[model samples]
Target: MSIPLDSPALALRAALHAALVADAALLALLGGPRIHDVPPAEADFPFVALGEAVVADWSTATEAGTEHALTLHVFSRSGGRAEAYAVAEAVAHALHDAPLALAGHRLANLRATTAEVRRESDGRTFHALVRFRAVTEPL
Candidate 1:
């Protein structure tokens, strides 16, 4: 079942979306990727996508309340800086758009700090820590 847009979950999703949209360089990096699918699971939120040469899996903590973390994983046929940034951008945008459903959730605060970009044999990956404060009242 989907939670109401006013729920805390929706608030968190919105904060994530804002964070991704705020970064242009990140967006450019993650361009031309297709959103494969999103699965419903506890603990981690996953968005799967297919890039030019790789498949990326971005997972983040979807816990309700305050202080959450997000991780992006890139799996590619070849590894490069451009590929890494692209994956990061896509993941960021996904998070930014995540909260579009929450209309009534009040965004008390949102802060995206602590960003890390890494390169591996598979591809490049970016990790970000997103902190937000929101409140949802019963109707």
Candidate 2:
């Protein structure tokens, strides 16, 4: 069997990126910052980064699936947890139970699992960690 171009992790990230970018409410909170899978060395304040996705096999006799543990990071030099939390809330709202179009897989379900906001060591940036659980099967 050929491995699909869009792997489970890739598909999940793509779906999330699309969902977040299209959400006007999220954009309102983000103020048009970058949402990156691979963020550069110096991105401006209040940008988003798609963090690691851990995938494990979850195949059944009838269908093959993967369980994805995904994380989205929000960085804000806006100097408080409020803006970051607002953006995180928007992300959660956008991604919870979202119907995402995968290239080579079908998303069985997606749900927000956890979220936390914290101040960075530098004392200015706020980091919002948002995690999700997703199940997908081959299309």
Candidate 3:
């Protein structure tokens, strides 16, 4: 299909969202398909939510490209950080180096960059932040 010129950031975000929801490992970790771009209120525990994203110009002299730094958040209520970390691991494993079909863009590369698991200020919720770095070129 021919996709017209579009924002590479949005295209990549859509592709990432679709890929996360479709991963069996991530689904198993979350106990269901609970990945969301904007999670609903009263969402269940141990779910994944799309978080902050930063996109920057990566154009060359004759080529147009973009660099994306995206983050995914895992929320859990387990007694410890283990559950949150596990969910984060699943997310990283599912996304790193995985081939994703993006509209109006071609994925040059995607890689898990960093992760941090900590207890929320409420002291009951464990939050895991997983970040990824990706590059895309206009298709």
Candidate 4:
């Protein structure tokens, strides 16, 4: 059955964890040799390692159906926007190629709405607000 976005805390947490794992795996697959290591503190973003990840909020609407919003907090330790955007593009590509099985859920489709990069205070760190839709066959 389809579970409402606000259905339960445990379910949401489980979904978030699964998504995180899938994201990490995708990044690893793309980063290849560059995939050095992911720090613990970097989990604050949606796609960590080359960047961090965070699930801001999600909700279900009758008009649009189901939607999930997330932010990728990328830290350009090297202080380069190009590098950060490249990392973001890699993440977007990975997410676009991610399969439902990878998410451990029967997702009908996943679409990336936006992937713009923004600068933080230090200018070395950037944040990418990657919004996407996750369609599933019921729950």
Candidate 5:
């Protein structure tokens, strides 16, 4: 199937969301696949969320390319930062170097950029933000 020239980013987002949710390590942290871009009010801890994607059209006459800036958020309410940090590490492992089969596109590279684990103002919840850079080329 051909992907719409303007919609490749949708395929890339879906591929990435699936990859993170299907990862064993990530599931172990959350007890099930609970990744989301927008979490519910009663969302559980240790969950992974795909915050946003900034995609730039990088195309040449022969091929189409996209440079993506992706952000992931990990939430936890454990006694300490261990649980949250562990989940963040698993996320990094799952995404970095992943060979995602993006529809109508070829994954050129995916790498973790930065991550920070800190307790929220409430001092009860931990928020971890992980950033990544991805490049995709049309197949």
Candidate 6:
């Protein structure tokens, strides 16, 4: 079935972006509020970018809801994986079980599911992939 025009996933994403940008802990790790849906070609190192998001129907007999599998990418050129991992920890601490306000949906639950940090193919850049799982119900 086709998804509704006013999708909860969109609302959830907006909320996530706002929350991440406003989180002081996460911002400090990045040296600024460098959170973006798509980073520019010259974006500074040690920044967080919104990555993939997979949405699925999670409706009950009487309730409409959604399940979101979201990924946030952390990029850094710092000497080692330490910086990337630190940023990932801040991201997880800010989001896990946090109450977020969405436009037309209520966040039922949000949790940091997984995080992985590794050196990219370039061999200099460190990449941290932080994944989150969230459930939202339309308001």
Best-fitting candidate, measured by lDDT? Answer: 6
For candidate 2, report its TM-score: 0.92
lDDT for predicted candidate 6 compared with the true structure: 0.92
Ranking by TM-score: 6, 3, 2, 5, 4, 1
The residue-by-residue lDDT of candidate 6 on 1-139, one tens digit each, is 7866678877888888999989988888899999989899999989999999999889999998889999999999999999999999999898999899989889999999999998999999999999999999988
lDDT of candidates 1 onward, in order: 0.38, 0.86, 0.90, 0.48, 0.87, 0.92
lDDT score for candidate 5 against the true structure: 0.87
- The segments of candidate 2 whose C-alpha lies over 4 angstroms from its true place after superposition are 1-4
**Which should have the higher TM-score, number 2 or number 3?**
3
C-alpha positional error of residue 63 in candidate 5 after TM-score superposition, expressed in Å? 3.8
Instruction: Give one clash count per candidate, in the order shown.
Output: 10, 0, 0, 8, 0, 0
Residue 11 in candidate 1, Cα distance off native in Å: 3.1
Which stretches of model 6 miss by more than 4 angstroms?
1-5
Which lDDT tens digits does candidate 3 get at residues 98-134? Answer: 8999997899999999999989999999999999999
Screening candidate 4 with a backbone cut-off below 3 angstroms (N, C-alpha, C), the clashing residue pairs are: 1-139, 44-53, 45-52, 45-53, 45-54, 46-53, 46-54, 48-51
Q: Candidate 5 regions off by >4 Å? A: 1-6, 60-62
Q: 5-106, model 1: which lDDT tens digit per residue?
A: 554554545544455545555445544222232323431212223211111222246423333343334433233444444454455444442333345544
What TM-score, to 2 decimals, does candidate 1 have?
Answer: 0.38
Query: What lDDT tens digits, residue by residue, belong to model 2 across residues 1-139?
Result: 5646778778778878988888888887777746888778988668788997888999988878999998999898886788899888888899999999988889999999999999999999899999999999988
Backbone steric clashes in candidate 2, count: 0
What's the C-alpha lDDT at position 60 in model 4? 52
How would you encode candidate 5's per-residue C-alpha lDDT over 1-139 as one tens digit per residue?
Answer: 6757546678778888899888987897799998986898889777888887888887788877889898889999998899888998999999899999988778899999999998999989999999999899877
lDDT of 1 at 121: 44
Root-mean-square deviation of candidate 2: 2.1
Off by over 4 Å in 1: 1-6, 18-28, 32-78, 82-102, 120-139
lDDT, candidate 1, residue 14? 50
- RMSD to the true structure for each prediction, in A, is 10.5, 2.1, 3.4, 6.9, 3.2, 1.5
Worst 10 residues of 3 by lDDT: 1-10
Residue pairs with clashing backbones, model 1: 13-99, 14-99, 16-95, 16-96, 17-95, 17-96, 17-97, 18-96, 29-86, 30-86
What TM-score goes with each of the models?
A: 0.38, 0.92, 0.94, 0.54, 0.88, 0.95
